[model samples]
Target: MRVGIAGGGIAGLTLAWLLSESHEVVLLEERPRLGGNVKSVLTAADGGPCAIDLGVRETPVEVSPVWRHIAAAVGVSAGDLVATTASRVVLRKHERSPLWVSAADPTDTARPVTTGGPAYRAMARFADESARWETEGMSWDVTVGDVLDSWPLPSTAVRHLLCALPASLHGCTTDEVRSLSARAVGTTFTPPHTVPRTTYLRSGNSSLVHGLAAGARPARLLLGTGLRAVRRAGEGFELVDSAGAVHATDVVALALPADHALAALSGLAGAGAWRTALKAVEYREVTYVLHHDPYGMPENRRTWSAGNTTVDGNRSETTTWYGPSLGVDLFVSQLDHRAGRPREELARSSFRATLPTPQACRARQRLGAIHEGQRLLFLGHCTTPVETQEAAMASAVAVAQHLTPCGKRLRDYLEGG
Candidate 1:
């Protein structure tokens, strides 16, 4: 079969790499750059030229089996990965002492999340119980904030601690965390005790992107060609590019943001229900800025050798600590949804921030219904509605298993993810 994939991000690239062996694949990228949000750059530091990841800084091993498989398959070995010391701090406002934290992995650190006090304990109890339903198909009928409000929350400090992690991890504010569903909160966040030390590609995240493209050379590579529209064409599909060109294929997998995919499919007669379902989920824009100075850091200076930190409350945006996540000393800061532009912005790019609300879960169900029926499939952060490198790879693997001959084995290995 001839396959056409739109949006050359990790999802599209991974799908193409897996399917190219058995099918004729054509990967189309809307951007001039092939690796959607996974961009890497080289900059000068005290040690000379070093790789700085502007997007997707790392591929954490403990939670990312799919990521590790791809990294190894792409020739990125354990030796090439840089692990963090796992030390983290929660510098909340109006607090005398900083709440020290570390990744859940068995790592030695000065401070642990358990020391956050009563509120932290209450939040962890809720996380532990709610996270169990994660595998049992937890209902996404309500927002996470609604559930928290009903719970016996200890104090504002604990509330901030609980919400701060997911807010910072997924690029939303504490308030926005309330808008998301409990299912999403659990999937996006694994309490600090479960959090493992993330590993990064020595060269940068983009190395995996380049490696995938090299491993699977698509029949046609159309860069800077964005999809403008998609309509059913006879037994297959017809795609119209931003350049006014037309292409037809037997199968298509949209590896794009939820909004963009829905927009492209708006005119399709079969996509009426799909557009409605997709519209149910809300999307926010998040900006990641790469800079030299720690403009967003706490008044007290911190080193990159330490892990990333989260500022609680409305000020809940800061650097995810580029130094440790990518083995570089640069700082990559995340701004709250619709926050003012950064001042020391050396590089900036906007990516979609998916809200996993009750409505979103319904939308996801509807999307999955469509996925199960058609040759056209959706893959990416929005599909899983969990923004992480592991989520991206996991979604791709799921779609590949459905379309591949050895799907059973692929499913067996990635099902745990």
Candidate 2:
């Protein structure tokens, strides 16, 4: 079969790699690059052998079975993984609470985010229940909002702190937290607060991205050209390119985002249900900042090596440090969702990450409608309902299992085998 994959993100790349073995593959990327948001930048003087990821930094080890397998296959082995050693947390509150104290400082007078108080109990209960749900094989019909409403102690500010897990981690606002599945909230690989910091590939995710690209080695890799249109070509699909050329294929797997995929299929046949599902998916955009400012930090100091979250109306902000230990004195701040910090003042520019909501999960479940009348497929965070690398890879694998001749065998052959 002739397989064409739209979007060269992790999902699209994985799909192309999986299907390429059994089919003639074409990987189309709207951007000039292949790894959608897996961007790594060198700060150690161009090619000086040091860099930092401006996006998708954390690579939680336990949660990334699929990614790890693929990475190893592509030669980006386990040895490339690096872990951060910051367990101390600094707490800064907007309301009436303890001032910012260094958790790492032995003599500093700061309290942990969890002091066995109401918020701690609430968080503990949330984690415990999420684990229970996982063990019991239960359906989380309720949202994370419901879980917060389950407890009625402290203040809204404190509740916002609890709500940040879904908002900051999952990508939504406090208002949208009610739309996040309770199960997803409870069952995430590593709840952010407990770990203090997250694990990452020491070399950055670009290595993993490059590995997949090399493994796929698509026969025709289209970069820097956007898909202009998509329509039926007899029994198969014809993808019109930006320069008004067309590439017809036996099968098309749309590994694009819901919006991008929907637009590409504007006049294509069998796109009705797919369009509807794509339209139903809701997303929140966040501005990610890498800077030296400690405005959001406790005492404006580097003591808060770990990210700290604060609530603003329905939105929240998290500050994470890429400090001296990490080879810099910069802090990566996830400014309020959909909002940007001072651009001219800060030395850093803003980057964005997609946040999935409960509505997105609903849309994700409805993707069967897209598959009903079309061989054209969907993948990525839009399909998986979470904006994590593992989720994106899992969605790719799931779709690959359905479309390829021996996809099951190929997927299992993880080591770039």
Candidate 3:
């Protein structure tokens, strides 16, 4: 049978690679390049050659199975696909005050965001709520506020942590999201605060995508293309392209996000409830700054919330770090929409806000990249409130399973032989 896959992301590519061995597959991607948000930038210098992870930065031990399987299938070791290291976490509520916690002693128990505290318990509760939603078949329609209210926590710290997870993950406050959506994240992966960050990849982290692309069977990739529409063509389905071109296929795999898939299938035939489910889902915005620093920033600097500094009612969690040699990465959500203000100034100010007010502090800016456009089906470890690669992989599997029965076999193949 001929299979047409829309959106050649990790989900789409994984499906296509699995099916191509036994079927004819045509993988369509809307972007000029693949890899979606797993953006990696390779350094041009020689010798101590290294690559920094600009996005999808962390791969915890809890979620290594899928990524490990992908690496193996593509004929590379997990280490080959990542740069693993111990992460030093720093805490500071007010920017440039003092480093409350550091890797030198992350267990000092003085910081607010420290693990194994009220924050961790709240995370556990959130995870439990997410599991409940999934088992009850209510994961699709719930909100973050719903989950929080259901929790039995009375501590202010616990409440703050609960509120922070969804807002940080989705770039939106708890009230702005569905309770089920928030739960979906928890049920999907380990709550972020509890997961171990042991993985980093070289070649800018895009190597995995490139590996999958190369390892995939022939006639699998159809880049710079999108599914414009779908219709019945004889016994099979006719998939349309952006320019109204048509390709008939026996099986259709929409690896695209819920929104993109729903839009393309609006005029297509069959699958009413599925369409409704797809339409019910939504996405959020995220921004990050990837910089190359010859002089490393203080280890006391890391990720924190900026909800207190917003001009409007919105707030953001700004996460920053230096992993590979003088490299600083900042991930900030809930950015203000001010077209008149210069982006560089805002990023610099945000960066400065994350640092100590030392008069002698000197650090050079590297690269700042932003993805402000509407995102689709971003139900993964990175964007999801859950903090495990397992959640992201499971969400992908669930989405795939919803469309076809082939998902089981694909999942099995990814898990093992």
Candidate 4:
């Protein structure tokens, strides 16, 4: 079979890499290079050149499986690829005592979630009910206010967990999100460990992209070619590029973001609801200031901590660090918006206010989209299972599984029916 993949990010590359052994694969990329958000740069630092990851700075072993697979495929050990890990997290706001957090696998015990606060236990109870609603094939697609009003939540912490984490991931306030979709994705992952050390790709995240691309080496790997349209062409699919050039393929995976895929495959009517769902979902933006400071050192805390800061009613700022001697990189979560703001200005402000000023700081900002189409098979920093390389890898693996048809029913085989 011949497979054509759209978007040359980790998902496209990983799919191509895994399927190349059995199928003829052609990977299409709109960007000039692979690794969409995984791009890294090596620039001149104070006295010498240092590598800085503009995107995907961390890969935690505790939760990320995509990096592990990529590392294994490329002959890189996960342990060796890790840059730094610290034992403590010191916060600017909570200076009295640092919270002890660890990622060691906690014993799983099915316990009742907490509730009991001024906000009323009704909210927590409602959330639990909404979760049950999803198992029964119902959706909680309403404002956060509506969700809380409809359910019985009893605790502040539970309400905070329900409200904040989803807001951060979905890039929307509780009022604008789907309670069912949000909870479904949120409850799927393992929580962060106290000592949350990020693993840096020594050669940058793009190294994995290049390795996957090299492994696939598709017949016609076109860069800077955007798909403008997709219509039926006999038994297969016809794809029109942005320049009016048309290409045909036996199997087509609308692997771009939910919106892009919807626009390209507009002729297909089967995707109406899927397209609406994909478009309805929202995404958060990520911004960072990358620089090296000589003075105003950050304590050797493992992961940067966020104080009690709020962005549009969301606590986004996590931590600031002064130590890089042990290979620690500064990371910030949650931002206001992804437009009009000057990158250098934001970097300067973040540098001046947080850690000591570095000789030079580089600001990198990226915006991701979240949508609802099921046919598009969208995978990026904004989708299921967290915004990490592991999601991309898992998506690729899932794609492979989907491409293959099943034979006898598993239950029949086991029961000999």
Return the top candidate by TM-score: 1
**Residue-wise C-alpha lDDT for candidate 1, range 219-322, written one tens digit per residue:** 57689998888878889888888899888888878888777888889888877777887788676666777777765555544322244455644546556566
- How far residue 272's Cα lies from its native spot in candidate 3, in Å, is 2.6
Q: How would you encode candidate 3's per-residue C-alpha lDDT over 1-417 as one tens digit per residue? A: 677777666656665655566567787788787766566655433446555544455565434677666656676675554443333332224344322122222252443444455555655666665667668755333555565667677664445444443444555553443343454445433443442345555455577678777866774587788888878777778888886778888766665655677787798656564465555444555654443331123333332221112211233243444333223332322233322232332222111011101110111000001123311222332222333434445545543444344654466654583
The CA lDDT at 408 in model 4 is 23
After aligning candidate 1 to the native by TM-score, how far in Å is the CA of 55 from where it should be? 2.2
Query: TM-score for each prediction?
Result: 0.87, 0.84, 0.68, 0.64
Worst 10 residues of 3 by lDDT: 359-368
Of the two candidates 2 and 3, the one with more favorable lDDT, higher being better, is 2
Which scores higher on TM-score, 1 or 3? Answer: 1
For every candidate in turn, the CA RMSD to the true structure comes to 3.5, 4.1, 10.8, 10.4
Return the TM-score for candidate 3, rounded to 2 decimals.
0.68
What lDDT score goes with residue 112 in model 3?
41
Better of 1 and 4 by lDDT: 1
* Ranking of predictions according to TM-score: 1, 2, 3, 4
- Across 1-417, the per-residue lDDT of candidate 2 in tens digits comes to 888788888888888877776789887888888787687665552235555676777766565778767777778866677656443332334543432222433333454434456656666667778778789955546677676677675776566656664667645666777767777666542333454334667677788888888878655778987777888888888888777878889878887767777889888765687788788765556556665556566553444555566556776666666662355555667755434463322323343445444556677766733443457777887676556788788788877767763664364664343
lDDT score of residue 277 within candidate 2: 76
Computed on alpha carbons, the lDDT of every model, listed in order, comes to 0.70, 0.66, 0.48, 0.48
Clashes of 1: 2
